[model samples]
Target: MAESAIEVLGVVRPVAQVRHMECGVVLRASDAVALTRAIGADELLLRVVQRVYLLEQRCATLSAALDALGASLRQPRAQAGAPNAAPLEPADASGVASEADAPQRAQQVVRCAAFPRTLEKRATDTLHERGFLVRPSNYDALACLVYMHGFYCVGVATKEDFGGALWEKPRTASDRAEGPSEQKRARAVHGSQQLSEDGGGAAVEAAAHNDSAATRMRQTSAPVCRAYYKLKELGSRELVAFSDCSVAIDVGASPGGWTSYLAERGCSKIIAIDPAELRQTEPPPPCVEHLRQKLQDALPGLLQRKGLAADLYCCDMNAAPSLVVELFTQAVPLLKPGAQVVLTFKNVYPKKRVWEAERDAQLDRLRSVADDVHLVQLFANTPRECTVLCRAKQSTEQ
Candidate 1:
């Protein structure tokens, strides 16, 4: 069909068959460092990239191919300095690397500002007919492919270069829309997946790197700040079972959104601890007890007095994960045996090491005091974070 279309237009198709197709990938600009490290270890990718990458084939095909290569896709990572700067290769265990290294090359960029409606529809349909997965043109994925390939041919006109084409007169919406006859083609191609919403970018980037930003928006519509969505998802998934449990200690609980969520969820008592002032809610939910002191400082005293033993512990500290783990480690003895701990391990700070390094380091610290550590990328989390749900191991068991 593609050949027929070109022939009908008196145009010649490129003779070279695509032995390997390049796919674009988008990641959280934040977790790029660690995710890059993981991608480096995998051999399936023709080339790994930051904002986008070139996969050898569809994600499913690559996974199978990866198995044959004795490798698997790890999340891609990024360099610490500039956003556009080339990322460094992973270092050895001791934070050291051999001096002999090749420098990274400059990347070509593609910006698809506009394209004609007929061309867009034909390209979409042809690719779908050939079983070639193309991320929607709007997504960063297709743009990456266009950047790497130089020009992505869509329909009537083949864009020769990125800069000139992107700066050309923008096509009107009606000019961009599929004609009545071609609308089915548009829908057919769209059936594969949407790059911006769900596609290779989400599969490799979010599943490998982090989750969607849309998740937070979709899961909640509360008046509270975005932080409220995190706790709301935690409970909705039964990840923490806050409603099933009676007492929950919320560390780093400023803004009181979690407290409010807990109160609404029917948690009998919520001890919200933070140094910052919490926003006052009307009638102030009776179950929430705001403690305006640092959890590290206040929790230890509570432990000393043997006054607080909670069924669950939760923290969403903006501090380093290691520090949060340390504070919680000391307070583990104050938690009821087999109580749950739900926390967010965030890549909130700049790091010299990969994200796994920080996550493993924190988990190591937590293991000494707690157990059953499972790190999950929640729908509510952005690319920079993950939710950790664990239980305080029975003192006698571990």
Candidate 2:
């Protein structure tokens, strides 16, 4: 009940504090006063409920222990004077159930989970007065305690752990002068109570609001999928430019997210090629052409029939980097002298050395065809993957 009302420190959601006690069962308590007020329960009534819940949990734990012990003891016991024979020890004597006595411990405790919250001294003192032992904890000891006990233990974190959790430092006088916009933005991004340390050890307020403006801008003009965000990062940096009537090609453009983005940015005509089905919320604009086929298979016919010479080319294929280079090289004759090409390089190798080598090779191939090549890790990309933006040289040079 206390967990229900008391907010979990360093977390935005309070419900995250609720811990499971067993399979299909949960135990939650809140500050007595808060619980009473919320449920219209008097102090005595709350205490009665708390006692009942505690009794139920103890019963469940005891029942599971007895079941495990019974199953173990059922196995053939050693003869009266056998070398391995030992006297039975009382379960309550050491406050520990031995593995020899309880091999089913894992099964017994599998459903149980504990909730631990770092609390101020006053709260710990209150719990202690109510007969709860609030132990002090370091991150390492916390895991050991939880594992040894087979249940949750409430404890306070060490100074180092506490310091790490409080990431924001108090803003200076200059920061306050930056205006309410920053403060408002921080609150919008991080819903949690953010505190920065002051000189006196008191906490000052700070929020993760530095990128609020960009987040808002993105929300207002949200694109179809995550692909839009990658392109937005590139476009916002002025990495590539597009004109009103610029012809473009989107290889592996299944879903047409990039095609839609290009259309909105004033590219007059686009050849979107993918063997997979295209998914769109609405029918595409007249300038857009969706070819349900692979880029390699369709490019030659498209070039011959339409005399296609694209001003912009985009590809995001999950294939080898060498294949990507070959695709661009083959399409060079159908690209304008300085056509812009934006592609993604996926790091398929698990090892760092292999990944770097593959990436470097891709960039080298890219440089051979384009005068300028920029490889950047886009926010939308997974670990080690990057987006490559380049401008193709003339066919004579190619």
Candidate 3:
């Protein structure tokens, strides 16, 4: 039947003798089959293309709706090429060094002032006012964040990020040890009676050197003092009077920063109390007695047995302000009538509104027991916490 169909589709062809006409019916039939198959394939492809187009349109509509709904979306944009941003070079991995002729890289020193605080806005403002730029090297940014949000001291990167850069002066081993020693000798010689007998020019020269040395010392010490003073300012202010020779109690004294400050000012004796050991592991300060116990447990007995009464009781325990205040209230009877108590309250718990309200209430309660109270908000305080300086109200004559 297939052979008959092929034969029916063919036409006569011209041979060697007999004349034959060729219609190419078989070829035409094959061409028709190919055309029909192509048509079928094209129709299938067209349907696929249409489906794809419809899917794309649907995706576009869904994307637009999401955008309108304010869903989290990221728009693609070209990356910015800032002029100041430079690519970092890989470190020299090879151990070899060229001795004959080598280019010496110049080290540039940068000076910066950082104020560590919690409020970024405030810290930025303060830095701007002080003529500092907010850059990658500036730790004041982190400090500001810390100040605004209370964080543990362990996470503080001030020493790592800001300290090294701010004070990166190269020094030799001998230079490091000898520099201060020579300074001391020079000062001693200048202040000696022997120097007094010298020529006026020598005296003048000595005075100039002394002044220069003093300036250098002041410059070197300024940053530490600045930070400390800022912290002190931020802490609540109460009348902290230092008598010529008097006893004081520094509660929650870990590193003994405050106790050392007091001792330097000629406080005869200081009872440094803390659960943690003081950082100065070598020895306690000459006048300081280290009490390795919680303040609550040791305070009452120590006061009674020793018959010791402190003129000033400074508490900087990191506990909640309310607890510190309550402790103070309990220990008040142990304190002399006219003695002054300085306590630092840190509002560490979350819910600032509730903390503030509770703090104020505690302060109000303290007023009923104490004579007169002065409450001052320290500028050094970050948003997380504040220092409260309290004094006992006793008779004016007492």
Q: What Cα-based lDDT does every candidate model obtain?
A: 0.48, 0.48, 0.41
Q: Estimate the TM-score of every prediction.
A: 0.46, 0.47, 0.44
How displaced is residue 238 in candidate 3, in Å? Answer: 8.5
* Clash pairs (backbone) in predicted model 1: 32-77, 32-78, 33-78, 35-75, 35-76, 35-77, 36-76, 36-77, 119-155
Model 2 residue runs over 4 Å out of place are: 1-222
Tell me the tens digit of each residue's lDDT in model 3 across 1-398.
12211112223222321211111121122222233233333422221111000000011122232221111001111111111112111113331122212232222111111112112234334334433343322122112111111211111113232233222222222223334444444433232212121111122223233333333533441211111332334322324556532878888777555676666668888888887766442465678888889878886578676567667777777788788787777666556666777666677767879888978887887776675566654444334555555566674232
Alpha-carbon shift of residue 147 in model 3 (angstroms): 23
Q: Could you give the C-alpha RMSD of every candidate to the true structure, in order shown? A: 19.6, 21.4, 34.7
**How many clashes does the backbone of model 2 have?**
6
lDDT of 2 by residue, 219-293 (tens): 443345446556656676677775523899888786566877788888888888888766554655887888888
lDDT of 1 by residue, 264-323 (tens): 788888888998877646768788888889876786567775556788888888877887
Model 1: what TM-score?
A: 0.46
Best by TM-score: 2
In model 3, which runs have C-alpha deviations exceeding 4 angstroms? 1-239, 243-245, 395-398
* Candidates in descending TM-score order: 2, 1, 3
